[model samples]
Target chain A: MDHPITVDSDACTRCGICIEICPMGIIAQDGPDDLPGLVPGGAAVCSRCGHCEAVCPAGAVSARYPACGPQHLPGGSAAIAPADLAAYLRARRTVRRYREECVDRETVEALLDVVRFAPSGMNGQPVHWLVVHDPAEVRRLAGLAIAWMREASRAGHPMADLFGVLVRTWDAGVDQICRGAPHLVIAHADAKNPMAYTDSIIALTWLEVAAPSFGLGTCWAGFFQMAASASPALAEALGLPEGHAPQYAMALGYPAYRFPRVPGREPVRVTWR
Target chain B: MDHPITVDSDACTRCGICIEICPMGIIAQDGPDDLPGLVPGGAAVCSRCGHCEAVCPAGAVSARYPACGPQHLPGGSAAIAPADLAAYLRARRTVRRYREECVDRETVEALLDVVRFAPSGMNGQPVHWLVVHDPAEVRRLAGLAIAWMREASRAGHPMADLFGVLVRTWDAGVDQICRGAPHLVIAHADAKNPMAYTDSIIALTWLEVAAPSFGLGTCWAGFFQMAASASPALAEALGLPEGHAPQYAMALGYPAYRFPRVPGREPVRVTWR
Candidate 1:
């Protein structure tokens, strides 16, 4: 493959910063005066980590991002203070109660954009997102999940007790499934991929961690995820692409309540070798 | 579990904020001037999410944290700027190459402390950590993983091709298994726990995200994890508590290089329902 990056000679100083910065050592400058390009077979091995384009001192190294079109964005820095970050992590709560409001499209989009940088197995970013945006749609999906739980309960599944409790709560007009959250975000990938479960959960974890920064709240929608994995009806409802299946999900919305204190947890159990 | 919280009568304002904020509605105030305590059977249902103690205005309420002792800490606010957080997320990279220096114990401790707040299924918080602080130990464990891979390769295992590549690299001078990182952090839980995989991965995701905050870097040790799951030798080397098995691990250290730019990713894929 030709060089993934196109160097504009006018702006190129040929300093080789990109070559050194390339994580895969793919970018090469044949001669000190020549512009940087990918080494032979470089494209096949490139993880597309974007380190080359990011470290370029000159504005000349532009790599094609077929997904977003070609764009060279500067690397982000650790601007947050340690103390504030400590507080931020401590402040996060598993928000199960949400106000009857929807997060605007732009805000949700921005949050996903941040998590897009979350790492995946071998940089094989196989996770795709399915945003259940409308509250009604979320409600319908939750119903399908309940449908599975109800059947599982009748069939005496291993988790029958838990399913029975949830189904009863749902029947009693409580949403134990999605927790009445207005939005549900599902992370999915090709079911055949071994890394799908881990990558999807990692991406969702990133989303939940970053949600509060946008004044939003989230809870792991485990019940929905469990049903999505088991119930063909729920799978049909999700309508993921041809080979994709849901691995995990989160209920998303404006929090109706507040967690005003940092509750202490069990002393971390660690064995240092 | 007599009222997990102790309310000081003299300092109690009896505003019922605790009652209102309790996610389980377990906290109760008998009279307008009365101190708050758990409702009948409330303790049984309480998730110990700590919302009641956090929401109290008076310094009267203190929750007993066996893990942390009796303390009521103020809830942290979202003090981080959204833009800064966006940049922080973008700046993160999966460091495959690491500097040889070891991270101090205090820094590793601080990172784990922040992750203690990460959520778990049913508030189980079942994940425990094992930090391999010795580089030699890490190398030894990597050799065990290589041994498993070497056997798998000879047996023509399904992943034999991938295992072959890793084993060949290990036989070479390169440290392909642990990436030569000074420390390895393993997240483990009871093998019987259904939530172990998701919960452990979520916890490790928290760790990797929080690592950058401590000027530390991490790479998911998937090969090591795979071997640990299948190899009795690696499991015996791990020495996790009885019935606990390794779920995931990360190579922890300072990065050898810097990523100066944020590489472009494929455009975000979303299906709006």
Candidate 2:
């Protein structure tokens, strides 16, 4: 609630990029020479998305909502050409084959450092990450999910058939849950907020897309996510923050193989109005 | 599902990338000269993720699940260096202000062409797109969303307070719902599959990130999405395919201004297990 919009007067050039870039249109300048200030009640409307600070040419403006001010834009323009980005996204594959070697904590940390920038509704940024670093722990968590599915199957739940296969797979020493990945990343947020669910998915998708850049690959842990959402035991095992529900999970690790091409996909199904 | 994973004997170099990349671990070859084939009952377990086709260096494998074959890898590697990609993702911003000029149809199509490659649950790829191109139609849809909010406010719903503000803003001609955006892109999918909801969000997230490359910007149309989800009338107005629910909506247009820098964000919050 204590969102501060600060300006470095000596460095301010009054270019007004921050004012123009503000989504809420709340930043204002009295004159050409004037430093921009938040309009009356601007803080209340501010989503704390940080456009003002990010758009400032002189690094003169800082939206100190989180207290971490703007970072230096490394190597000037941080943009990948559009075509290159599209190709990168296209060429990405859901990595199921992961090397036994565990990814170091720092690499995962660095990846999340970038993924945390993924957009959230009203910039709520409610998604919090839970990284299961220990491979044994990841397997144990998968076991918890299997246990839940086993119970559900016994109860003749609607997903009983799916659960039966998963439990059977687990019994056979096949990991249909976490895909034998060395690391698992779970996104959790307030369960009551509808936006939180979508936001978490967006964040996880960003993590999945960005992981390959870090020599890591990720697969959505659908089975684990199913159990996490339904089983209190799994939730308790995760020990996520209070009042938070697991939104989704991703199995992450160094991929055992590399993808060389972008696959052909279903034609774009669009109904243009 | 008749998911045929075939390999071209002539083109295959027998490097075995496809076999290694298969998430199901079902792709096999008896010897170096043997062409890769599915193990017994492999098709039953195949997630249809197309990893075999994407990873094959010789462009020999084809997971023709949807009858789509492998696409040529445009150039060898389209990957942006990790640091550049991280910086690019970090620099993204939600654009509220828009230029009057409408984005060309071709640009939108090209953007979607790339977005079609976005990953989905089990490669289900259920997310379908509805693009509202005409500015007048976009405004009319916004009006309908406002009307829905007005009714909800009148009904004294729990969200009435927020809807009341949105309705009032609409009345003031401030265009809060669509933000006067010339185009609106919506992602809708089968309501029964919970994965579709998350997949839609991921697809839209990809769209948002890829938009700037097309010289456009997008803001999540939360207000419109809320109404689209709750009001049958709005859903009918959207004319989404039968049995489909609107997962989310995004307002798209040429940005009024360019953001010069990436905004500051909250420190990455993680619970390392």
Candidate 3:
């Protein structure tokens, strides 16, 4: 079979760089046109790595990702410039504290306007968002989340210590850590679908990236999401649809604190092939 | 728990727009610190949504994502201008096919370099990449993947029909449906961690958004990832660590075809609160 990306024979330079760079070794000379072409006379196999495309200096090759097609967006194809990407990547953060003010309905609608544009699996668009602004409802949900954590803790889950912190905070008459933030954006997808997490993460990432440009802070509330998924009352209060599982919950608000410098960390591990 | 952003009180106008615009209802009017200050007691729950900052006429608020901190990059704070954001959102896609030619090593390295900067759950950074370049190794892994599928088919799984297609394709001596794309980028994370998929998705999304800027195409390959996770031979061939589990995969290549128009889609369901 022809690889999803086919080379134009007319533009062939045969530099062999593609063969060397292929992470999967699917590209080869004199390969069968059918039966996954990289297998040698039905002997070899290709991993479908695009290293060859990146390595080719002749500009003679072209590649395509499957399942992606033209006309995929509401307004059509618009290119994101490098500068914009740099800005977007630089601005996103996971926020914890918030100012004690209420966000207006208009601004929430505006942010949703951009979030609706987030990409989905196979264009299935399975992602759904529940925006909670009422202080009472947010707190109620947080209570339910703590209850779930207590259950998990009793079960000896490894992260029980973290849950203990939340429990203690609530018990000490401190603010409800989960609901203290005024805006709770809960992202959900069909629980039955394997790709639900992917859908939620993709949408959440889009929202997080866009938030910085709007001057808001976001925190990925895994505890809340897990609790929502585990507790039907919390799910109902959050307005998650039946059969839809909450994958991520983000708390949005203004910052209550400041740091003098970026937190320190060890160097990252990276390999060059 | 202080949030990561703050507004300069001296620069405040008390116009009430920030409170109204905040998605998280953390902003409120209160006399704290012996002065009428926009106390951020609730800001600790911020999602970093950016609405308050974006709408602020005076630009008093500033937030910085942890990954884009001063120590990592030279910029004090980066924000994608509105026009640039419009362009970036427009260009995103999920590509699958690829050209037969090789991609430059430096270019692939550059892409990986950006991915290295992606955030992880609690800075775990458990995610690992298996870049397959050798055509033979790619083929070996693909064959093992097909074998796994065949085994699943014999067991009478629901996806038997899909596997039947693979069998028929292989029998007819045609190309693998995965395409003969020469490169495959596999992302794996710790199996024990709940955030493994989150880490993988974040890194992959970063790469996907950045690929178009370099004239490359990408497609997420969940099926391939599943196969690798389920089959030990495939996992070993791909060099996945003992405790690591595959979370996501993608095919990359040069585009053999281009469509003149962006694809159309149904309007996403969005609620404005």
What are the runs in model 2 whose C-alpha is more than 4 Å off?
Answer: A1-3, A7-36, A39-41, A56-60, B1-3, B9-20, B24-36, B39-47, B65-67
Tens digits of per-residue lDDT for model 2, A1-273 = 454688889999988888877767788989999878988888888878788787776878877776455676776567677788788888777877789999999999899998888998888888888999999999999999999999999998998997898788789998989999999999998888878888898899899889878888899988889899999889899998778999989999998886676666778889999
Report the C-alpha displacement of residue A21, candidate 1, in angstroms. Answer: 6.6
Give the share of true interchain contacts found in each model. Answer: 0.65, 0.77, 0.25
Interface RMSD of each: 2.9, 1.9, 8.7
| Residue-level lDDT tens digits of model 1 in B1-273 | 556777888888888777766656578887897778887887678777666666566656777646632233334444566677888877887777788999988888888988888988877889999999999999999999999999988998999998988888788866677888999999999999999989999899989888877888898998898999999988998988999989998899998776555677766788888
Any runs in candidate 3 off by more than 4 Å, and if so which?
A1-77, A81-84, A101-107, A150-160, A173-176, A254-273, B1-77, B170-178, B271-273
TM-score per model over all chains: 0.90, 0.91, 0.68
TM-score of chain A of each: 0.89, 0.91, 0.64
- Candidate 1 is scored at a TM of 0.90
Angstrom error of the Cα, residue A5, model 3: value is: 24
By lDDT, rank the candidates, best first. 2, 1, 3
lDDT, model 1, position A147: 92
Give DockQ for candidates 1 onward, in order.
0.54, 0.64, 0.17
TM-score of chain B of each: 0.91, 0.91, 0.68
In DockQ terms, which candidate is top?
2
Candidate 3, B177-252: lDDT as tens digits = 3455566777777789887888889888877777776677777765577678788777777766678777887776
Candidate 1, number of clashes: 3
